[model samples]
Target: MQCISANAIFGYKKSAKDIHKLEIDDETAFIVEMIFDYALTGKNSIQIAKMLNEQQIKTPAWYKNKCDRRSYEVDSKTIWTSAKVMKIIRDQRYAGDMVGNVRATTKVAKNDNIRVDRKEWIIVENTHKGIVSKEIFRKVNEEIMPIKERSNVAVGESRRQGFCYCAYCGRLLQKENNPVNPYLFCVRQKYDVKNGCDEMKIMTIPLQATLSAMVVKYVSSLIELQTFVKRSKMKIFQNHKSAMTGDEIEKEILKLKQSTISLNQRYHEGRFTKEAYILQKDKIRIQIEELEDKKLQILNGIGDKEAQKEWEKELEEKIEKFKDRISFTESELAEVISRVDVYSQTEIRVKWRFMDFTAKATDYLVRAQKIAC
Candidate 1:
């Protein structure tokens, strides 16, 4: 994994045989955390980027692309931009995982790197400790999802239209001059969605209404999910209650005890001197005593129910803070939603942020894609 990209939190180990683990860069990690936190406050990528640049913070790309690490040019060229901020949030690496072979190999040199469908790509999670929690990562990306541009959108077009897509084509919908399929519709041109999709259009007005309501509902449900997950994590840890498995320590104990038994049998058969036998028995018994002590230490650490509960509380509080920042502001309705798909004037598919969190929360309350037409 470290071999693929130089942008890893931690670079590859000196040992070639070692797994490429994420090494946290203390300097950049704080920067990343700040960016994610600011983003939750209804700031767009451009706004967040501007703030970071004004604070004289070095961009992540600055650490990567600059040939001379020492040069300090005080110009816009040496600062964070919207594109950089959006790229960091969109990356799966900040969530502490890397995906490989996501694009099919192509013959054309420039147009060759088309992304494969997500289902077809390989995903390996929890490979290393993430700088941001999975929930935080998901939350940030949920905010800044790109919307397609339109040529003839009305002045009063719904801000929610930025979150809409074409159900048939999976492209971000574009508002146009067409009266019949007015508002967000797909002109599938990107290879990712263009092929295998028939032309599709959705009426803009109703889609905006449906999505706005859904956004409010999902954010409300997140409050309960945060509370439930806190208790559940603690209960899970307490139930297991062991740092090392019982089988591991027991196996070691059994192995050492059998060595003493073998020594006794050998002594009876006159295979060694009494002096030799005594020394060997003493060594085996010492090992047994050490293992017993280690077993007790491990058990005591895991059995600290109070400690585990306290830790869970701290985690829950952090999650609450993160969740509190997530909201659908009137100015940035586009930030919270990824895309809505248009099926008809009365029906559309809304893909909200926090897929797993939102999916579970809105399971009975909302439909996924197919809604009333």
Candidate 2:
């Protein structure tokens, strides 16, 4: 088959004679063959991955990076994973087939490539020399794929589908649909015990209760902060207005205008020079402009207070809606909570989306109180 020069597939490299043609990479091909052999021996993908990791074999990603330094960059700690092993076992290229349109990207999500249905894939058989024989590939697929599919059947949608994660292994926890009580546990613990992940199983009901309480507490705090900020801003504005009365500002402007009149009369009477009269009149003009600007600012502060009242009302209404919520839907949870890390049945840490905002608000409140004092 033809290999793209941009990034050649694993276990194959571009031919020196023809840049478009692919040649078997002996080192990576042996690894691909070993994966198929393991599948033929009734070993599951997880088991095969564990065996490879124990042997400290470099993964396909590492091989790809070795062949072309720019293709894939992998750390020294990179090890074989079940997903990587399964991908090698299912690759048609190793069976001498040319497969196309196996995955496609859409206009709406250009970066997200989704697998096309098997029936829609364009696969041509016996296109090139194979690392594994066609018969062996067929047998491995027929024997191992069905069992994997059966084990992965979904029972129902989980309420905490994408939010729950294992605190130890940092893997997404899978939901188990137990009849009495549904729970979430780390799937890695089931497959690989030595993977440094503990057995994590937390019931969905108690988790939901914890999340609900956290959300209620968060909403109550936000409402209080909003009220405090509104009142504090109004109080600051009132104190500022009391410090400088509008009547006092008007009197200052009147005095400045009278001084300008006196300066002009002195210049006409030849008591002061033209330049001195002009400079003195300009100074008085500036003082009157400053007092006028102050009056305008005070008037605008009244308008700002009215607008603040409306904004506070709208914010309070939204916060109040969540303060009394007994439970959160999956979509609602996704909007406010970024993730929930489950350490155990009783210990979980929730990261809320508004944490940064809350911290900034608290800082502003402290500064505002300091200024008010």
- Give Cα distance to truth, residue 351, candidate 1, Å: 48
For model 1, the superposed segments whose C-alpha errors exceed 4 Å read 1-3, 6-19, 65-76, 108-112, 143-373
Q: Can you list the residue pairs that collide in candidate 2?
A: none
lDDT (Cα, tens digit) per residue for candidate 1, span 1-373: 5425433432212224444555666756888888888877767666777677567787654664453433554333345655556666666777878677666756756654555655686777877667789998776665344442111222222322456655554545667756765565554422123243334655655555666677666665666665665565456456545444646877999999998999999999999899999999999999888777666654444444475456446545534544544343534556556666676556766665445543432331222111110
The alpha-carbon lDDT assigned to residue 212 of candidate 1 equals 61
The Cα error of candidate 2 at residue 354, in Å, is 0.9
CA RMSD of all predictions = 23.1, 8.0
Which segments of candidate 2 are over 4 A away from where they belong? Answer: 1-6, 13-21, 58-81, 104-114, 144-161, 239-321, 366-373
Per-candidate TM-scores read: 0.34, 0.67
Best by lDDT: 2
State the weakest 10-residue window (summed lDDT) of model 1: 364-373
